[model samples]
Target: PPGFVSLVGAGPGDAGLLTRRGAERLRTADVVLYDALVDPAVLALAPSAHRFHVGKRAGRPSVSQRAIERLLVRAARAGKRVVRLKCGDPFVFGRGGEEALALAAAGVPFEVVPGVSSAVAAPALAGIPVTHRGTSAAFAVVAGHAEASYGPVLDGLAPGTLSLVVLMGVGERAGIAARLRARGWAAETPAALVLGASGELVHTWRGRLADLPGLALPPDRTHLPGTLVVGAVAALSLRSPHSTEAQPAARADARPT
Candidate 1:
């Protein structure tokens, strides 16, 4: 019998956010290669599978991308049902596309099971909608893992763009804010940092764009993955009144047009 691979999105950080299809793939996996940030509960879904950690983080040792692709091909060719579990939508900067292409080139059977991206979920979980009727109607999502990659996105961004969502950006928050300001973005533009989104330890910080560089995380969580949101909507939180998450205060100062 032949084997197959499924690139499953694990969602932001909560196991509950895993899609029905993603869950189904995990339940049938004979071998699971999961990212570093996948929640433990999600891994529990594949109890009988042989699990391997192939997650990557900034400043930490990680399995190389090429190596991971090779592993997937080898596993499938060996007649094992493989699962490449990723956090968030695999295609949303999760490198799922690269892996998929590698599998195709190798003639290995594989499929992508999309998951919720933290770019949108992080802001929503923090009570900030990326778009609102009058507040904002357009947005851009960019990866902040490298300045070379994100610098062009920031430079090409229109002055009137309403919202910007950044993933893997905490380490470069200061540089990003500086570039946005240099591009004529107002210092007082609303901004937010949502850490550990959709998880029990989630925390949100909100203030003017200028305040981003000054915002600090707990020493322990300094390297925690985060989503950075900028523009007027960052100051709005539509979470239920009973929601315990700290909501951003509505901006009293008018945002720049």
Candidate 2:
């Protein structure tokens, strides 16, 4: 019997946000591999399945990408229904493409089940829209871990005209801000950092672009999974007019493990 693989997105941190398709795959999975940031609640859905945690966090030892891919291939070759569950959308910075390619090359039958991405979901959950009429007509989603790749894109953006959503940028907040400023983005541009989006530990910090580096850092200086939103729309949060008044703090659940 030919084995199959399913790459499923678990959504940001909220188990409730997982798609029906993703849940279905989990229920039937013979083996499940999930990311570090995926909520435990979601993992519990595949109670009877063999589970592996292959998630990566900055400054922490993690299962290598190659190892994970190999494991997927091996599991599928064993005629098991393997599920690679990732936080947020599988294709959106989840490295699902690489896994899919590996599966294809290994002749393993596979499918991808998309889930809501933190890029848009994080900001929206923080009450800020990535795009709003007369505020931002376009938005750019960039991986902060690869800022060098965005140099040309950043340089071409017309600052206030385009909203910027940065993922995996909490640690590089200062550099990202400096780079944006160097690219002619205003220091006073509205910016918001949404940490642990859609989870019990969700915390929001809203301020100008100049405040990003400081606001993104907690007193402990530990990096948390966060999404940075910068532009005119970042200032238009529906949560509270006082959202910017609180200094960023780390919640027990939001701390990177």
Candidate 3:
């Protein structure tokens, strides 16, 4: 019999945040295909399943999206209930659709389970809300990776248009900021890098689009995932605990017309 599969969302980075359904699904999965961003404790939930790590990081040589799909097909063909566990909501830049399409083409049965996205959770962990009244309304979740290698994913961003929450953007930090500036974004626009998202280990670096690259960007940690916020809403950290009031101001999402 062709085994079934479930694309489970692992949430931002906190294992405790995993939904009851997500945890249950992991515990019962015959094989678990997880990403680098999944929390270790969540892996413990799948104690019995064979765990496979699919690399999808910034600069490091990670697994190709196509190869991951092939692996899922291979495992399912062997009659294994494979769990395609990914970080954050599978639909939001999780590449869940690509994997799902692969399964469908192979005549595999599958289900999708959603979870909290790092785009939102990371800012909250650092005391920065992506949305607030009298401040900002709309937001964008961008991919900083230019490609499978280290680059930038524009996602059609505009200057002072929307607050951008960039995932996996730490590696291409300089390039990302450069791109934003090239696209009419103000150099003084407030930008932030929130490392480890919701994990116990977290660091928030605040800066502007032009100065972001100089703010302790560690190239060795390319593969390590982090979230980047670019806009006035992201700068709310100054008012909150993420930073002191001395932080520089960035261009607000909605400025005086």
Against the true structure, whose lDDT is highest? 1
How do the residues 18-81 of candidate 1 rate in per-residue lDDT, one tens digit apiece?
A: 9999999999999999999999999999989999999887679999999999999999999999
TM-score of predicted model 3? 0.82
lDDT of 3 by residue, 1-257 (tens): 77988998899867877888999998888999998878899899999999989957545788889999999998988999899999988997888999999999998889998898888887876767788887778887877666443233453565787788887767678877777777788998888887765654455778788888777755554344688998887677533323332221211211223
Ranking by TM-score: 1, 2, 3
**Model 1 residue 87 CA deviation in Å:** 0.7
Estimate the TM-score of every prediction: 0.93, 0.89, 0.82
The global C-alpha lDDT for each of the candidates, from Candidate 1 onward, is: 0.87, 0.84, 0.77
Residue 183 error for model 3, in Å?
2.4
Colliding residue pairs in candidate 3: 146-151, 146-152, 190-250
Q: What's the CA RMSD for each of the models?
A: 5.5, 4.8, 6.8
What's the true lDDT of residue 127 in model 2? 77
Model 1: number of clashes?
0
